[model samples]
Target: MTETTPYDADRARFTRQALARLVLCDHAVDVADGAAGLVATENDPDSGPGGRVSQAFQLIELAERALASAVIYEREQGSSWAEIAQYLGIGPAQAEERFAANLEGWNTAFDVPYRLDETGRKRIPQLPTAAYDPAWACEKLDRWAYVQRIGIDAVSSGLVMAVPEEELPSVTP
Candidate 1:
């Protein structure tokens, strides 16, 4: 039998924070890749400003893609819509609608073939599709890096921890 390791509260907290940071870093990498690609495509010095804006747009698209991936991963890990919505600072319905809209496309774009053991069925895992848009990926990387920096501040300040339900202010009459 495999030995089970007991959960350490501090370790759990650290792991969660680390994962968030990783997600942010991934987004930044995507943005950087996109920007680099756009720079390589510029033939006219006069179009530099326009190319920069294009690169920025690509980064926004990459951020959207990264958020989509996070949503999917969280859902698969059993996170509730309400919890996710709270984390995203959005209403549950809005989160569901936004995620659902892009979920299918994201899945289709990144799906990799695989097989299931339980049902002996074949399947594919969804992969991040940002790579398809190199410029967007680069821009996304930049934005993600910025977000990560902000997150680091929040984490360091103890603002990223999960509050106990009892500690939350009551809304009931």
Candidate 2:
């Protein structure tokens, strides 16, 4: 007879919770990015006033949760000012000024964990640099560029759910 480990149930539950958390976080980011784009198009000098304004308002309503989520995730991820600025495509000072208050409050609310090294510097997990698939990478690059042109808020928000599950392109033999 094989013995079943009781620890397995706890592990499975933890995994599920973790996956759910990640999914929610990602969803938030995506919404925020979408909202930022709508705002930009509405603000565009060349865009006609009527349709663009309505679209922007609609996007804002749709993206509030996403923007909140991105702020929370970035704070938890311990993103540096420079990194955040780069993500926003703005000067570091501007990024900090724009996001610092919101980011701080969001981080505190989420109780996101942080690590401190021997040097007492806080550390964040590095995002994977390699794409799971070349095609997915190309698509992501294009999407990122487009979002980036609108604002960093869009980029940050987009990043929340930007990881595609199909990137690995499962193979069956």
Each prediction's whole-model lDDT (CA): 0.56, 0.48
Residue-level lDDT tens digits of model 2 in 25-78 = 455445655665554422355556576567667677656545544544555566
Residue 67 CA error for candidate 2 (Å)? 3.8
TM-score of each: 0.41, 0.34
Cα lDDT over the full model 2: 0.48
Best by TM-score: 1
lDDT of 1 at 158: 31
| All candidates: CA RMSD (Å) | 19.0, 19.0
lDDT of 1 at 41: 34
- lDDT, residue 108, candidate 1: 57
Sliding window of 10 residues with minimal summed lDDT for model 2: 125-134
